[model samples]
Each structure stands twice: as structure tokens, then as C-alpha cells.
Target: MTTPDSAAADVAAKQRIIKHMNADHHDSIRRYVEAYASKSMFHSRSAQMVDIDLNQMVFSCGGQQAVIAFDPPMKAMREARERLVQLDKDALQTLGRSDIPITKFVPAYTHPAHLWNFTQCVLAMVLLPRQANWQPGSLLYDNMLYLVPGFASFVARIGWIVFVYQPQFQINVMGKPKLALQVPVEYTIVVFADGASDSLLHGSLSFSNVPTQCDFQIALARVGRLEKGKKMKPDSASRTLMGELGLIGSQKEQKREQFDYETAEKLCVCSVGPPQESSGSKTAKCEFSLHIPSYLPATAMLPSVNISYAIFATCILPDRKVLQTSQDLRIVRETVEPIRLEPSRTVYFPDTSFAVRANFDPPTFSSKNTTISTTLQLYGLSLPITNSMRFTETRWLVPREIRWVLEETAVIVTGCPDTTGHLPMSSAQRILKRRKLATGREKLKLRYPFTRRGNTPVSMHSDGSGFSVPLTVSGPKDLSLDASTALSVAGGHILHAILDESNSDLNELQWRFAVYLECGLHIWLRIGEDVFDEASGNLVNRKMDEMAYTIVCPLTTSRTVTGQHDRGDQDEPVPMIPPSYDQVWEQPPPEYATPEGFTAAEAHTTNSLVPQDLLG
Candidate 1:
């Protein structure tokens, strides 16, 4: 019953589907394998669709095969594509890769073991020992004379030789040894209440070797404008003592400035020691609470200046030897207060001009969209007397385009030279110098434009004296504006409108606009002026009319569930309608009747007449 033409058509359709899937939807296949196949203990590095039908899909990963079934069979290609997208999203959510984009999931090529490294294999075979007595067919020879051990030994020797002479490799393998005291967790200190409130520093310290006496102190240092190849000097008293003890030798005098070091707070006294222990190594728990000075600046690292704080713990041994350990802390300023602004201004252009006014409802916005309403009033329009005159009149001073933009600016350090010149002919020095330099001490600006929808055209009055146009604008859904900061950088939203007067036989006009800021702050803008250079394409002239507002949207505290749901048995029956109340309460209540008695009192005492054995 099978026809040759029908079979060939079916084969052609299948081949087309397979080719499309392999070319375009490779990422989806890889995601599917990572989500499902990985859970089944089949760790497939890559997957390709070998065969696909309306009801099922078969994938091959390095000759290993897997099949996935579609619950509702796809009837069209569009439906299949939609279903594939939905499945990919579900798999990403289940695998806790929701933040990762789909295009990043490329299939990894898995090479066969024999084809992994041909040169290494050849070298391994060359280094392998030859045995003439071993026969190829014997089980003993095949099991005992294997070349795996010899190849492994040769590779290990080569690796050791390559890494032994490299100092950077040795340092990476064996890091700088720490002191006897070890702190497992780093501490983050927050400066709040305008640096008036106190922050607590707490951690546990374990000692591998115990010392007789230990002194712990918390030091705060403010270092500024540190030049290259210059060392910071200690206090005058310490320098005098060192000089008196002949510790300072005759050396070249270098221009150096003393760093500001202060004992902000003392954690423990000199009498403090490690915790008492019976036999095992001892661990000490330390805690310090101190109020940070309001005059001190928050922690910041720049090219020329740095402000930092640390906790130092020093141990004095019996032989007058000292061991020390320290941990750095990070400090940040608190959130800013909310702000709101509302301004009204008017400007005059020429004989035919317009007055534009903008208003923001509520004035303050967060991550969500905010609505902006603008009104334009046109006046001094030359009226037409007759139909011929009206036909001769041309359109002039029309509002051409309106746009809303959100801009963000931040000041960061840039263009700093490398400070690793002290390393002498080390590989790390070369690597550090060869690394690309970061953009430092520069301003970061991000601009996002709002999309505009279609609106009605401008209409004129019956008298032709004046006309008004009212429009509404909103911020984009994907716009992320930062809160306003007075110290570092500022950000705000701006609304710009361009009017076309090309058809009119009038000279170009310039109008000044007012920008209102909080706390007696204001900015002025000049219209019909170019803010940037035409030939250089650089912002030579600054636009003072731009305004920045604070957006205070906090992140959601809810946690997303990334686990997969269990698909219940498909063969089980599912009712179209739920059971009714009457069906659920099918059992009726029993009717109660009083026992027949000669008198009411006897009826009440009927239970007493029963025998004791019957009651029991």
C-alpha cells in the first residue's frame, strides 16, 4: 500500500525540519540536554537533533541517543517554534539559569579520547618501553602490559618540568603563607546615619600555634596623594626611637609625605590571649563596637587618594618574635532622601511663536514608568481672508518631534599607570604590565530614549487667532535610573521638543527655558542653539537646561522557585466538572423518635430502666 512518491515526500519534509533545527535551535537543544539529560546522570556535553516528528524528538550526543515526547502533538511549524521557546524558558527557570540569556548557551564540542591530542599520544608511544616476549592474543599480556601507566608518568614529568622553573606558577600553586592566626570570613562594615552611628566588627580567629601574649587593635588610616616608589613614614616618636637605636642607615633622601594613622578604637588589651584549651588548638572570638567619627570620609579608592580601615592582631612569642594578621573593611554612605520639583515659565519668540509648559504628576518616580504632560499654545498666526489666500498660506512653526530621555552619570577613576614595577624580572610583572589598562577617573553616561506612540495632529481655532496642543509622554519600561547623589555624580530625565519653521519666511529665534532644582538650585537652557560641535562631533557647549531626578525603586525581597514541577500521571482520568454539593453530601441525616412511655417523667428515665449488663 506504500507509494514511492508519498514516502519520498515524507522523507524530504523530515530532512528539512532536521536541517532547520540543527542550524537555528542548537542552543535550545543544549539547554534541554543540560536540564533533563543531566538530571538522569547522562552528562551530555553537546546535543544535536537526529530525528524529529510531530509527537517526539530524538537527539544524539556523541553517539548516545535521547528521546523527548511532546504531550500535545504539533500540527504546524509555528506552533513547534513557540513550544520550543516555552520549553527553553521552563528549563532555564528549573536549572537556576534565569539570569543567563539564551544566546550564551552554545553547544560544546566533545572530542573522542583517541583524537584528543595526537602529538601527546605520539610522544607517549615513543617513550613507551618495548617488550618482545609479550604476545598480542594472550589475556595476561593485554591486561598487564597496558601503556596507561607509562603515558601518565610521562605527562606528569613534562608538567613538573614546565612549572618548576616558572616562579609565577610556583606562587600560584603555593600562595604566600599566612601567620599562625587565621580568620575564615571577611567583615563588611557599613557607615550609616551620616557616619554618626557605630558599626560592629565581629569574627572568630583560630590559631595553629599558641603564643604567650597577644595585643589586638583597630586602626583607621587616611592616605592621600601617594607618589610612586615612595614609602610612608611612621610617627615622629617612632622615627626618633629608631634613629637612636641606629636602625636608620644612610640612604638616598626621597620626597615622602607621612600618612594619617589613628587608633580609632582598641579591641582588646595587652593582657588578652588565646582562649583556654585542654589539648587541641585554641580559637579566640573577638568583637569591637565603635562610633565612627563624623568628620572621617567614607572608604574610597582612587588613583591619588585612598581611605581605609583595618583590624590588626599581634602576637608576641617567648623568643621576642612577633606575628601579625590584619583584615580590611569596606565602608559606604547611606541612602539619600527623596526630592520633588515643580516649575512654571514662559518664553517669547517672534510674531508666530508658541509657549510650552511641562508638568510631572507626583514629580517623584521609581523604577516604574512616570507620566509627563506638556502643553503648547501658539499665538500671532496671520489669518487668511479668502479661500485663495488660505490656499497660498503655508504651514509654519509646527511641532516636529518630541522625545524623552533618561541619562545617568557617574565619576570613576581612569588612566592610572601600573604600580608593579618593583617585581624584578618575574613572570607576574610581565603579565601585569601586559594586561589592558582600565578606563579610570572618567564619567560614565548612559542614555535611554522613550518610545512614542501615534497622536492626533494639531488643530487650529475657528477664528485662526491661536491654537493649543496637549500631549502626554512617559518613561520607557526598561529604564533604570539611579538615585541622585550630591557627592559623586548626578542623574535626571529630560524632555526635548523640536519645532519646524523651514516653510515660514521668518528669521530663526532663540528662546530661553528655565530648569528648577531643589534648595535654590536652577538651570537655564537656550533653544535653537547647537549643544555639540557640528564638524568635530564633540560636546563643546554644555546644556544647562537638562534636569535630573531621583528614582527610588528597591529590589523585591521575594525568592523565586527554580525547582521543576512533577507531571502527574497522564493516563489517569480527569473529570470535566467537579462533583456537586448534593453528590458530595449523599448521606442523609437519621430521624430521631422519643421512646413510648406512659408519662413524660418515665420517658425521660427510659435509659435508667435498661439492665446494667446491657448498658455495659
Candidate 2:
């Protein structure tokens, strides 16, 4: 219905408008993505479910967001804009606006609708703090580059019109077309805390992407020393001390050899004497080193040294009126390297040369009342100057087992109180006591044990040092009773407890009482029901009897990172709703706002001046 001249003008107008819209899309996208980069954000790692053509560019789009992971030419935004620009041309001609360019009209109304969808997809990919993405200019774009594809160069030449007058639109551009996002997902990484599982393990390449071999040499041993003195003749028939030493603990005792003669000669010459009268007393020293293996396969099972250590406990409660208990414990050193240990996870330690015998007796509980018996043991031991070994073993390989020969020797037990003429307690005992009456606070008095080595003394205090019973419940609510057995050594302690009448209690009445010692380390025990019977102890084995409870108590009151690292970062904030379809349709589209020094009509009139007028 329009004239040929009008139709031609309308086509030109439509083309102009489409060009402007594309220009706006590009410029805005740059601003958006850059805002995300400035904040250094990260998006969730979840993959999206895309239904686009496999042959065409496709991207994931689900969960809180979706993103097109590709370079500039491959950007989904570019492809979408191309399709939308074509639609803009068709719409403008249909409107019969022959004189106005599609570029000018599209900016005034059509473009924002298409942009809203694109902006929505991109915003979802941004990793920012909750509620941070809404600010304007947080992101920017530059659509002028659309001309680089040659045939489309005319499109960009038109966009340059705005840049010529509006310099504010041209500043602070980013290099590399990266989809920088300010998503909050980076916070989740902290959940893997210190001594936690799957920590960052450093991996390096040795030119050829093959695994490098790591060799380990483990050696563990006990050394022995001897002192020589003239033998005090034995009343019964037995080999002389000199004869036994010549062969080194063998059945066929060899005669004293050249070394023995040399030792004897030296002793004889150094014999003590008084005023020329011979006293005939001298001494010679002998020492030897022995190697023993104490480590098993436990250490190799660990993923790395940065992991925290873990302990596995099993408590045995007597069910048959007759009280009995069997306890087997193994102690190994950890932290020469950091290692990860899951709380309550069972892991074995390797390269440990420490061993101890499980010494326990079945506690005799009075039948009249539910009686409790607790046994505490310290698993690290060093030989007295002359203490003998009854058995020994080297179990460092698969199905490791102990191998040994028990040897007895004569050496004085030093550092033991001469008054008692007995060895001191091997280590420290932080709380060694029992109670019967009930109170609001589990007010059991604590006793500490200590040991002496040479002149220096070693007391068993919690690593950070001191007791940490915060609020003691006189008795666990619902459960009739509770008890604990703990020892502190090498800055750590084994804490064990038993509960009674646990089933009838509500799990919600739980409370956490923590002990903070002077050393700044805090040990917390959760007094609650054992939802999982995995807790090893006496109460768990007897289900029908008076129900029982188990609480985690620290042997040495110290703070652990495990207690501090809870699931705080897992929560994510809901993002703002994208500009809606109805809103985008109803909203005013972008227009060239007049710059400070120029009026629109004045600007058009100014361009009307001839080139020659500028020369005057």
C-alpha cells in the first residue's frame, strides 16, 4: 500500500534500528561481564541441560543459571543477537515507519525485550555475593567489534556515532572476551578445611606425563648399653658374667677373648688404691644398637600428610550379670606431615614403631546397682635403662605380624623416686576418678598423673593444657547415668564414656558442653543419644538392659579445627528475578540521552552547517 520510495526509506530505517540494537547489546554485555570480573566471582560447577542444536552453538541452562562456555565468535549472545536483529528489520517495515531508521526506532522500543533474555542467562552464570549483581554499570559492552567480520562493517560504522559524542561509553574496557562472573560459589570451597579430606594435592609433571616413583626407607630400633664389673660369684652353678657377654646371649658361652683381656688390663691398671694399698675396683663400658620395626600398613592408606588424625573406639559393657571387658589398643605417631582425618572415620597409621600390651581386668560391678568399670591405658612406652623385652616383632608389610626374642638385662631404673623404689607413672593422667551421686553438673573431680625422665619432668596436660568441662549436666536428661575415662599424653588423650537408660530420652534435649583451658584450645563433648550404635562401648552391646548414652570427651582439653569447621558456606542466596517478558515489553527501550553540552534539535541543526563554515 506504500509508494516505492517510501518502502525503500522504510527498509533503510529498519536496517539502522537493527544495527543500533546489536550495538547496544554488545556494549551492555561487556559492562555486565566486567562487573563480575572486578568482583572476582565464580559460578557453581554444575553442568546445565541444554536443548539447543548440537550442530549449532549450545549451552547449559538450568539450576540457578546457565552459561555459554566459548570464545568471542562462539558466544551465544552473538548468535542470538544476529537472529534478533533480523526480526527487528521485519517488525519495523511492518509498522510502516518509512522515514525513521529501524536503528533509531529499535533503540526506542524493541531491543530491551531480546536483551532481557540474554541478560538473564548471563546473570545466572555470575558468581557474586548474594544481592550484589543489581547495580548498573557493574558490567559493560562494546558492539563496535561486530564490524570486524567485514561484510557487517557498515553496522559498526553507525554505532560509532554515539561514541563520537558520548565518551563516557568508551572507558575501562577488559581484555580477552572472558565470561567473568561474580557468583558466590567460591565460598563452598572452604568447606574442605584444614586436615580435611580431598585437600589440594600438588601435582607436578616430569616432562613425560608418567607418575614418579617415591621410595621410602623406614628404620626403627632399640639400643642397649652395658657396664662391666667383677662378677660376684653366684651361689649356684651358672655361667659367669664375662662368659655370657663374650657370645652375646647364646647357649654356647665362649671364653673371654682379646677385647676382654684388654678391658681387664685397663681395669686392673685403673683400680682404686688408698695410700699405696690396692683397692682392686675398676669399670668398663659397653654399648650396642638394635633395630626393630614397629610400623604397619596404616600410613600408606592415608591420602596425604595434611589430614587430621582419627581414633576408633569400641566400649564393651557387661550384659550377663558377670562383668568382663577386652581392650586392644594400638598407638602410632602422626603429623611429621599433615594428614586428613574425617571425624569418626576409621583410618590406620603406618611407620609407627610404638607398641604396648593391653593390660585390662574385667571390672566387678555390684549386682545391687548398675555398676560401672573403666580402664584407661597409655600406649607409648620406652625401655628402662635395663628393662627386658619379653617379645618383639617387625610387622611392616602386608598381613604384618610381630617377630621377636625376649631379652632380660640388669640396669638400674633411673628417675624413679628412691623413696618408693618404684618406677613413676609412665605418662600424665588428666582426669582419673569415679562418682556415684548425681548433680546438675557432671561434677567428677579430675586427677592428673605425671612421669619423670632424667632431671626434667613431663606432665600429661592437654596440648593446649587444662580441663574443659563447660556445663556439666548432673545427669544426662532421660538417661539415668553417665561416666568417662580419659588420659592425656603426647598432648592428646583418649576419652571414653558410658550411658544408661538412653532410649526413652528425646534426642532433641541435647546440649554441648565444652571445656576451654588456659592454653586457648577448647575440647567439646556432645551429650546426646547415639543415633548410630557405631560408637564402641559397653552400653551399645546391652540393648535390653537400662538404656545407655555415650558422649565425646577430650582427654586433654584442646581446640580442634574439626569442631570449628562446620557447614556454614553451603547456603547460597536466591538471585533476583530477570527482567520479565511483560516488563521488557512494557518498559521504554534505550534512547540516546542528550549529553550535558548538547540539545537534540540543536545538535541536528549544528550538523546542518556546511564544511566551509567551519573554516571561517
Candidate 3:
């Protein structure tokens, strides 16, 4: 039924598809065979599409033939590609998987969407207080808004937080930096009191910490000077107070480690909204970014240090009273997951005495990637050539197992507290998975040992012939109630936020991968090394498969470079919508010309439910 010309074209098309799939979409072929043929091959790794026809597609999954029939046969080769994508989608859904492809990625957008409604509300409250119709009203008739009757009275009584003609401000982080951020100050206050002098919105960021202690070293010293005409006995168990003199020896003097209660440093001073009334602009937008760089000895609260950031703002009211507020700034640090993968991605996972270099299936990897192809290889486990094992001619390992894990390592770094003798430290960890490379012991041949000594760093090399080992790490899975897993720069990982639930760390501490305090793929080998037995206090040859070699595999990520995103439209003015009748009462009509009710005539004062001021 088929013509010669058509058959030739079809053959060429089939070859192209096979080559492409085998080269790039090996996982897809494996999935197709599993979805269309059998779920039994789900765990089996190897998959290759060997043949295809109009009626059926054949593949080898895990060394077994899997034939999948095309119920509606494709009329042409071009249709094959489209149909395959659809099949993959269906297969992914059916198998509870995601379309998150197996590929390397780069950065993407960061900030959240703007709250236009809230923005308009704050702008109205500040720029047009008296004309604006909300919670606060004119200073004169503000108390009487409840007497007459209506919706305005309801809000006035309940929303007592905002005061009439009062100014309020809050500091928020606009963007994060390596060790700094754009501390954008937002103002939600009424206009400066009429004829108020020296009306400047001034503030400063202050740093405070516990007492600074000097670094000391332990050394042997006689305390004969402290003990006059008496011999002091040394307590072998005493870690301190050795023979009546403190055993601590002062080393090279370092900078003061912390601050005292009496001593506080103002890290940076900030003037919100252009020095008070510079341009007479009601909407006091913060044009300057408060950059808190990590240069000072007491700056940015570097990890393990106990410095705290507090924002202090001072304002003068009409009566010349200075009103000030100070709130703690939650400084969050993000861990750097920087990885470099150029034309080649043969990355080395180093350990003390062991090392492994792996070339991934996609030749690149990040937290966004799902799985690794069976092309992994390990090299050497070099140890220091110490005196004990100097004559060791050969090296051997029982080869316990290889484990891939998704682990979260958290630390609650307590700051230098005011009181001493308190060990300020806390930590917690959660493991999502611990996938093993084998179900039983691995049998391998003994080979020549690798050794290094004296200043030459170990674990930068590999000894054994590394081969591709099966790795089964996949995540960001979808389930109804399952908690979220980690992602990379490309995968929209929040990276930093206030913890939703209370944690043992700090009350509001949250971080990821800043310092060694990061979570990601952790791989380790359960192999034995020669160590002296503690019980016998002698060298023992006994081997045990305890966790020895570990490599916290850093995630390689790629990000898309994008211009300034989420820039609100400056051209369009926010439309002020009048309140409905449901929010108004018969006694006093609702006002719209202002957010603050600073009306000159008492008649327009609408906050009063009763006409108390008008009748007076």
C-alpha cells in the first residue's frame, strides 16, 4: 500500500526522531515505555527507543523490550513529534510527575506583585487626609463621628489604631544584596501639622550586641605569684582555674568582638521623604536606598555574631513633643549556591581522603534538575601518608553503599547575650530522602593505595576507576498536603522568609545556604578507614561501614537576565472610588475630596454618627 518515495521519506524521518530521542530524551523514552507498557520498569534506569512504525513504537527499558501500540496510528512522520509530546504530558500526569524538565537553568524574576489597592489607600491617607473618607476624620469632630448613626461610626470605633492628623512610618526591605539591601522607607502619615517647625523625618539604623570578649589560648604556666607562702595543687580535671591562676593565655589582640549596653553605634543615618518638607510633596516616597554594607567590625551581623539591627525614626508634633519609634530589623542572609559549569561539567566532589568527579547526563546540574543519568564515576580516596599506614602496599574497600540525600541543616545562632555562662546555640535538621545506590554490599577488586602528605591537600584526586552509579534524586513533587521541597535560582525558590511556624532558632530567623547553613543534595560513602579503637586504646584493623566520606554537592544554577520588572505605571493615577451607601449614614454624608478629614467648616466633618458638632 505504501509507495517507494513515501517509504524513503518516512525512513529518514524515523532516523531523525530516533537519533534525537536517544541523544537527548532518554528519560522520555523510559517514561513512555513505563506509561504505555508497564509500571514495573519504573525503577529500571536504562531506556532507548530502538524502532518505530505507524502502528507501534518499540523501546528497550531497563534491558527489557517494551512495545507500545499507537491506538490511532500517525498518518505521517511529522505528526510523530507532536503526538510524542502529548503522550509525555499524559504520562507525566498519570505517573504523578511534573513537567519540570531535566535541564540546567538560570535566574528569573524575584519580587512579588505590587498591592495597588493598598498603595492607593496609603497615598490618599497622606496626600489628602481631610478630603479622604476612611477611618480618621478632622481633628475637631473626630470624636463625634459615632453619635449620629451609620457605617462611618462602625469603622471609627473599631479602627482606633490610626489617630487623626497623626503620621506613621514603616521600614521595609526592597531588594537583597550580597551583604546589603535597599531599605525602602514607606510613610503612612498625615501632612505635617500646620506651621510645625523643624518638621524633618529623620532616622538612623542602630547596632547593639553583648559584651565583647578577647580570644584566648590555653597554655601551661606556674601560679607561684598568686599563691604566697603556699603550694597550690593542680586539678587534672579542671579546665579552668589551674593552680589558683586562670589557664587562659591572651593571644594576638583582635578587635572588640561585641558591643556593651552603654556603647551603641549608629551604623547609618536615613532621612525619609526628602528631609521633611523639601518640595511640599504629600506622597513622601523614599528615593534613597539605605545601604548597610558589611565593612564595619559591627556591621550586617555576619553569621555567628550577635549584632541586632534596629530602625529609629524621630518626628516632632505640633506641640513640639518628640515622638520616636524603634523596631528590630530582621536581617536575613541567603546562602550562596554559586556553581560554574562551562562547555564541560566534569565537577569534582571532594572529601578528606576520597574524591569523585561526575559527568551528568545533561552535562549540567542544579537544584532544578530532577535526576541524573547512569554516567557517574568516582576516582580516588586519598589519605594522609601517616607513619601507621606508610608501608601499606595495597588498598581495599568492602564498598558498603553510596547514598544520595536531600537534607536541611538549620542553626539557631544565639547572639552574645547580656548575661554570661549561657551557651547560646541551637540547631535542627530534617531529611526528605536517603536513596541508596545498592540494596546489598558491593564487591570490587583491591587496587594500589593513593597517599599524600605534608601541606599537599588530600581528596583533590581520585584513585579508583569511577563508573556511572545510579542516582535517584527527584523532587518539587505535587501532592495535596505534601510540604514543599527546595529549588534553585531558576526554580523560584523563596530562599529567605520569616518562618511560618515558630522554630527553636530565633523567634523570626529564616535562611537558606548562607554560610555552611544551607540545604541541598548530600552524598556520602559508607566505607571503613583505619582508626584506633577507643575501648581497647590500641590500633584495630576491624572494619565497620560507618558514615565516613561526605560531599555536600553544590547545586549549579543558571538564571535569565531580565530588566527592571514590576515597575508600576507612573502615568496612570489611582482612581478614588467613593464609598457605597452601606458605608454611610443619614446623620453625616461621606466626604471624598480627602483621605484625612481636616475640613475647615465643621459641617463636612463626617466621622460623627450624630450631628453633635453641627448642632453646637
Question: Which one is best on TM-score?
Answer: 1
Q: How far off is model 2, as Cα RMSD? A: 43.9
Which window of 10 residues has the lowest lDDT sum in candidate 1? 429-438
List lDDT for all candidates, in order.
Answer: 0.36, 0.22, 0.37
Instruction: Judge candidate 1 against the unseen true structure and give its global Cα lDDT, from 0 to 1.
Output: 0.36
Worst 10 residues of 2 by lDDT: 262-271
**Model 3 segments more than 4 A misplaced:** 1-265, 272-291, 294-310, 318-320, 325-338, 341-376, 379-401, 405-466, 470-522, 525-616
Give the lDDT of residue 482 in candidate 3.
9
- Candidate 2 lDDT by residue in tens digits, 217-335: 11111111111233364432354554455623333222222111111101000111112221112121111121212211011111111111111111111111211111111222222
> Number of clashing residue pairs in every model?
7, 52, 34
Q: Weakest 10 consecutive residues, lDDT, candidate 3?
A: 217-226
Clashing pairs in 1: 412-441, 413-440, 413-441, 414-440, 414-441, 492-548, 492-549
TM-score to true structure, per model? 0.27, 0.12, 0.23
TM accuracy, model 1: 0.27
Total residue pair clashes for candidate 3: 34
Candidate 1 segments exceeding 4 Å error: 1-196, 226-272, 278-284, 302-306, 336-616
